[model samples]
Target: MTEAAQKQQSEESEKRERSPGGKFMLVLLTGFLLAIPLFASWLLIYDRQSQSEQAEQSIVTGWGGQQVFSGPKIVLPYKAKVQGSVEQDGKTVTRTEIVMQNLYLSPEAMTFDSDIKTEVKSRSIYEVVIYNSNVTGLATFKLPDDFARSGIDPATIDFARAEIRFGLSDARGLAANNMLSVDGQPLVLQPGRGLGETGNRGFFAWLDATDLADGTITVKYDVKFRGTESLTMVPSAGQTNWSVTSQWPHPSFTGGFLPKNEVTEAGFTAKYAITNLALGSALTSTQASQQVYPQSNNRPYTSFDSSGEPSSVTINLIQPVDLYDQVSRATKYGFLFIGFTFVAFLLFDLIGGVRISSVQYILVGVALILFFVLLLAFAEIIGFALAYITASLATIGLITAYAASVLSTWRRASMIGGLLASLYAVIYILLSLEAYSLLIGSLLIFAALAGVMFVTRRLDWTRTLQKRPSS
Candidate 1:
């Protein structure tokens, strides 16, 4: 070619490079447009999760109610079934009966009310579990006061805290004798029975009485029982109606439903009776009336702080699910997806040439980001599997369409689209397998990157990133 022709060719190449700006703009626009779903996903799904947590904390901190002390005292009416087996001269003789009525009342309540109205009857060794913690220091039982008025000496009941477990053991020494094994495991008669010690946080209980005999004792303990209390979420109605069944950590409400009318402040009402006397015997229930004040505080949900201060405070019910760990899990999955997409993009670029443009790359990145956003959103609303499908399908469609348009060839576009479809499907599978997402995602990402790296090891980078003149 002549010098003039060569110079003309260089000028044309410069002009083509300048015109690629429009192509870049188109790619960026497409990417931003595709990111809409990702943004939406963040807003809808994760937001609710955070809110639910706040509600949970509020319930714990605002534990309110008319604290009632029901029992430093109870009456046990018995139809004497004294089954005693005395080994007289190595011979066994046993006799027993079956009938007993136990009347239990708070010492404070029994003072003025002399007549016991409620009747509780049990057969086969009925025992009621009582705890000292159930008796409030602020509330004194009226039993002593009544006895003083009646000029009768009241019986002094000294309660002791001791750990107790029950099972059968052969005739062993009472102090440090062999405990009977009921289920092959030596049942501890008492574990941590401290009369004046604090109970486990968020959990409280007391034993009704100590084990009477050590050898071959058939014992029954009250471990779980449901209690009911009325609480008010909103006070405008002048009555509170809320109930909670006492379960560890999170309790379910029976008959205590969410408020029907929409009010600024949330009013909760429910009743829960103590269940599980084995842990702590004396029971006290709390029923609060509209003490939450969610609306006035500007936090309509259950939260300790109005501003939701501990935004990062993560409380996971599942074992091994920590806040930082979950985030790391998500991050690992995301990195794998993006890294794979990058490799795939580069591979497709080599096969299809500059015709695909950097705009296509931007579109692919947007699609990858959307996968995460969609996964998070759908996982929140529906679940991880459904959300992943929705997001992956939408993103794959967007990528395939963009690829087809940019390449201007149905076959080429479809091939790239299929490749992306496969990639996203793998990513979703990784995300779903939460325990192994990191391992799978990492392996897949490395595989893709390695494949691309091996295939393009001999390629010239200067030319790859450089503008090519249209023929």
Candidate 2:
């Protein structure tokens, strides 16, 4: 061969011999195809999660949404006069306008003792948390002494139009067997939000002439109600005491006050004692003025913000672990599994003298992504842990068997299998220990990178390429 042609041929041969970085770039290019399937799997997980949430909301709608109570306040309806301009005989004149208003008096004391029974109701593959609470209440309401002297006429205060207002977030949750009594007389509730302004989300009952004896009213009620997820109480009284007992193991207590609580595998019991002193003066909004209900029943009794409503104490019935969340989290780690497994295969192909085609890389990628699909499907049926073990064993076995066929030895394949097993174990641990997952994952990436760099530190590129023997 001529000297120029021989030099050109040698350079061409060197170009075909890929460095370790160059080989990884090839692997990455091929791995890019995996994104299509990876994204598809992610979307599938999202769709399933959306379906599960929809099912829970469906169940809750048929039952009842979360329940909140703020009630047993005395609502004294009264008439107030306002001056307004009127046109009479084509001339403007001032006239006295008679408007209806109310005086809301907070209860001196309120107590709620509740026993909640929770159960898991399932719709297809979804489970929803629901509860039936048997709540008994005792409250006392006495008119504020200065109501008549709050710049309003005592004669205009219609004591006969007095109502006992009891607030509820969802009135439909009230069971048919509920009972309420004021001053030894049974009260028939009317469908209306008893409290004025933004805190008006409950039912009310009118009081008879003798019900408010000596300007004081006593209320007793036994309510058996069904609700989904959570229950809350508003302490709209001078002193509030609430006790809740539930047959569910997981109870998430939240809101303005933390209850003294005891929890066990069987159930939980929580108690809260809150005084108006802690509630502050906002709870007694418009207490200085007798007019509280509405300008003409078309507007709120007064301007209200969140402070207009009494701060609530809430308890949420939650599952210890949700399978959908576990699966979604696993799906997020999909690329890690793909990248690590590809690196193992790349190591064998480049240094161990194995020939792994892009088509084969694609097949292996398909198998890895299928693991997530299998996990989600079985998780719904058998829960997350067992399903994870099942999916991992199946995926690891499939890849290990294929590794033996491609790498041409049982020993090399065993190494691949061990790597797969370790990855799966690490992922499972990461999922279980969520608070420390980021720390663990960051450490894992650092270790993997260091190992890869160390392994390639002295690797030669000459052996990775097989040029035709010189003739």
Model 2 ranges off by over 4 Å? 1-19, 83-96, 145-150, 194-201, 209-214, 282-310, 460-464, 467-471
lDDT of 2 at 435: 100
lDDT of 2 by residue, 1-471 (tens): 999999999898766666666777878987887988988998998999899888899877857778887666776666778788989999999998787666666778889899999889998888989988898999887655655556666577677877777767777777786788987889887877545432466677777634443566778998777888899876767888999998899999988789999999999999999887776632223332334334334222322226664467889999888887889899889888999999999988776767677778988999999999999999999989999999999999999999898888889999999999999999999998999999999999999989987887778754456633221
**Lowest lDDT 10-mer window, candidate 2?**
296-305
Worst-scoring 10-residue span by lDDT in model 1 = 128-137
Residues 82-120 of candidate 1: C-alpha lDDT, one tens digit per residue: 376777778897856443322221222111111001111
TM-score of each: 0.40, 0.86
lDDT of 1 at 265: 24
RMSD of each: 21.7, 4.7
